[model samples]
Target: MTEAAFSIADIPIYGRILLAPMDGISDAPFRCITRRLGSAYTVSEFINTHDFSKLRHYQIARLAFQETERPFGFQLLDNDAGRMAEVGARLYELFKPDFFDINMGCCAPRVTSRGAGACMMRNLDLIRDSFRRLGQAVPVPLTGKMRLGWDETDLNYRAVAEAVVAEGARLVALHGRTNKMKYGGKARWEPIRELKQALPVPVIGNGDVNNLADARRLFEETGCDGIMIGRAAMANPWIFAGLDRDEVPIAEVFALARYQVRAMHAFYPGEKGLVAFRKFIKAYLAPCGLPYEKIVQLMKVTELEGLLEMLADIEAELGGQGQSRFGWEGLANPFEKEQKA
Candidate 1:
């Protein structure tokens, strides 16, 4: 393994590229896959305290992780400072994660409408209070993931970041866009540069990084201590291994896909696992040029054994082990720069 890129609190992060903590998507099975492929560490999906306080089984299950996923974290999302601290402390005793991350970046209406996610940025006092309380409540290091702010007029990420760190946040991951931007428009990298210069903790730059090339640009342009990949990682997990989607061989893709489905089945069990696996089928087969009909056929399968068999058939039909039947032109490669003649 390479030397640590940077440390959060006292924990050393072995790699600079980390899989972003995405709700519904960054589960234990997926985190383990990415971690094995070279992602530095794992962070559980957002554990909404509102749901957790109610003893929601799904919310509690999100915290499940293996020992291999060390330097792991539980990302807590809620508007209540005391509730967040209370849950953070309780969770530490139950799960013993290496750290706890406060979610201040999610812009989903369901999240912000309650003044939780990005809306939390509108209140600096809450940010300070929440972190201060969490610092006191949880024994592990506290961290934060936030946006530029509520919107263009409210770009106060600097103040929000400082407020959290003042209390005890050891690391700050900044997604360059504001809540208003949601996911539209280009993610502003300048603010990430600004935060890197201003913040005392390790700054992980996120947003608009879709591949290894974008990852390189983020590190070069911002001089950030780390990079976080989100949406792009869904289709091309090999990005964690420093390989682009097109660069991955068909055999390797099929093998990983099989592994992921089996793991998901074990994690979720029965048809529940098969249903969850459908979300990823499209992305894993994106490079194959598999017809819409064939893709739909595979997704509609209701059993794990049946689905595995179908995947094997598709892999063989598309060019088994040593060859690829898909067109390279069909796959998007943002890293391929225009040449100047």
Candidate 2:
């Protein structure tokens, strides 16, 4: 690994690579599979504070994980200071996570419209207040994830970083872009370098880190303690382990996908599980050398038996492979393309 291992509040993180939490994607099944593949730590999906009173089984399922998924945290999102604290206390009392993280970096319109997520950076005082309240209520270490700010006119990432740490945030993950940038513009790492220089706590740099080379460049460029990956991980879960995606064996990829699918079945049963697992079908197939049209057709197989039959056919077709040249990066998400088109 290019970046050496580090820790957050004395909890030794065995590596410098972590899986950034995504709402629908980074659930227990995925997190557990990635942990075994090599990710150092994983954060839970952003749990909305308001829904705590009447959370469904599936909503709470995000928090469920095995002992192997240790050194994990529960990420809470909310605009109200008191509610954030209340949720923090409740999470500790119920889940007893290793730590707590406040979400200030989500840039979705619905989240920002509510004065949460990236919008939190627009108000430094509220950020500090919320962190303070959460710190007081929870005995574990407090951490935060954020973007540059709301936009260029209100770039207060440094100020927010200073405030959160003062209020007891032991670590911070900064996704180097603003709300307006979303996932479009290039992630500016210079500001992340500046923030790392200013903060006393460990800083994990996030944004646009798609592969091992990207991770190395970010660590070298920003000097942050760690790196967090989001979208790219969905394409290649073994990314953090420095596994060359281009050299991955087709059989190995198929086996891993089967394992993850079985895990999904165990966690989310019947059609619900099959429906949820559909999104990942293309991601897994991206590393297989099958034709795009064939892959697209295979991805449409919703029934578990049909999917397994297709995998068996693919395995037989590619019998001579040491490592298939097909890789995770640059593969198209056919579902996303159909939506946009």
Index of the highest-TM-score prediction: 1
State the lDDT of candidate 2 residue by residue for 218-293, as single tens digits: 9999999888999998888778667757755676677776666656665764566567776786786676657978
Error of 1 at 173 (Å): 0.3
- Off-target runs (Cα >4 Å) in candidate 1 are 56-58, 322-341
Q: Please estimate how well model 2 matches the true structure, expressed as its whole-model Cα lDDT.
A: 0.80
The Cα local distance difference test for each model comes to 0.85, 0.80
Q: Relative to the unseen true structure, what is the Cα RMSD of model 2?
A: 6.6
